[model samples]
Target: MTESADDAVLALPDRTLLILDDDRPFLTRLARAMERRGFEVTEADTVAAGLVAVDKTPPAFAVVDMRLEDGNGIEVIRRLKEKRPEARAIILTGYGNIATAVTAVKLGAVDYLAKPADADEVFAALMAESDDKAVPPENPMSADRVRWEHIQRVYELCDRNVSETARRLNMHRRTLQRILAKRAPR
Candidate 1:
């Protein structure tokens, strides 16, 4: 009797991971942090490079950015899942949205996280075994803080142009400038 694909014993993958992001500083920091947490980290700065890395050897885990200069991170994640079906991946974005998050989960991503996520949170998400509800934060962001973050996000999206941000947000340019100058609310 010949052994089939189903009959073959599956080998557990090692703790190898790929981190793909366009932001050089964040990529370096995340790589160092993930290394400290015991993942053999491989870093790529573009979707093309990410694809090359995946083709070379598909990692057991990945953290891909939602948008990049070369292409969308979804392509990289798609290819990784194709090569390594058991791979667990996550999508990180500076701006979070429901549609993209839904797509990422459908493509085998374990979770989608907004930017500025700490190393501990990323680690926990990677290691979670069940699709259990996340514990709510005891001290969530205040309304003012949320508003400030929204403004900042819009500012960045508008290429940091104060006038453009103000116009898009339907606020006075001077008022937008004032908010930009102040420190973020806690």
Candidate 2:
């Protein structure tokens, strides 16, 4: 039994899929959904477990969290690609950044997606058939909004220290304070 949202089946010779994430609930839900969608799902919560799975049986597809509690998912991607050169992998992360995305792709990840992405989006990323770039997001974030989001993320990573965050972002402390005090842009 499965939800209709995941009823659409994926036809492929090797439907084996490896999904690694520390979020237990998300991992369980995604594992179930992928199973219903015709994948032989193997779920792991840590990088070590992911590596074991990759070594024992390289999956045809993988969805790895960019930053696991134990280690970065790039190591898993690297091992999976070494074990199975044609494996398709995607990095899922809450802290999405250009540097890590580029690293993931360079290590043979098929795509990089932000956290909270739905099953359909993950499926689409894994199964893309061509070299075409991603289509524009239907509701692209405004540039102001993107800047705000980046600033907020950096701020949090800086432990909410305004001076450190401002210094790292190369913005005046007063300007950052003003932005932080306002509501996020739509």
Candidate 3:
């Protein structure tokens, strides 16, 4: 009895998901949570590792960080699309911006989500179809929250150098520090 190729393929379950993030703790926790949710999760801390994983076995779903210790996650999305055009990709970032979100969508990401996103949110983004109608946010971000997010983004871009961030923002270093010390506004 010879097994057909299609039969062999059907014998394997398809629940693979790839998660790439530079934050070790966050990556570990997210991977574990996804596993609990019944996905066969593969994780990478850098772009290179992620590319390798895509090459080996392109996942059915992917959650990629916008910034990595080595490179941006957009490259990973591009490569994944090359290998698996049907794969759903979501770009996750702590430094969210309209420009980057546009780029991510163009690179084949199904969604772009800001950081501190829980596993449930990530999963929802991954599972949502491209044609699904998006529900607009009930309340948009306040000016203070936008300012706080911009400051945080600049601080990360400066590699957490308070003085450099302040200089770039044209603000006093002490003032920047004080604002950074405060919790984000709603």
Task: List ranges where model 3 is wrong by over 4 Å.
Answer: 1-13, 136-140, 147-186
For model 3, what is the C-alpha lDDT against the true structure?
Answer: 0.87
Arranged by TM-score with the best first, the candidates are: 2, 3, 1
1-186 per-residue lDDT for model 2 (tens digits): 763423443536788999999999999999988887889999999999999999999999999998888999999999999999999999998767666888999999989988778787888888776595896666666788778878877897799999999999999999999999998776
Candidates' RMSD to native: 7.2, 4.9, 6.9
Question: Of the candidates numbered 2 and 3, which has the greater TM-score value?
Answer: 2
User: Measured by C-alpha RMSD in angstroms, how accurate is candidate 3?
Assistant: 6.9
Instruction: List clashing residue pairs in candidate 2.
Output: none
Candidate lDDT (C-alpha), each: 0.84, 0.88, 0.87
Instruction: Give the lDDT of residue 178 in candidate 2.
Output: 96
* Each model's total of backbone clashes: 0, 0, 0
For candidate 1, which ten residues in a row score worst on lDDT? 4-13
Q: Tell me each candidate's TM-score.
A: 0.69, 0.77, 0.72
Clashing pairs in 1: none
The digit string of per-residue lDDT tens for model 3 on 79-102 reads 999999988899998777776888
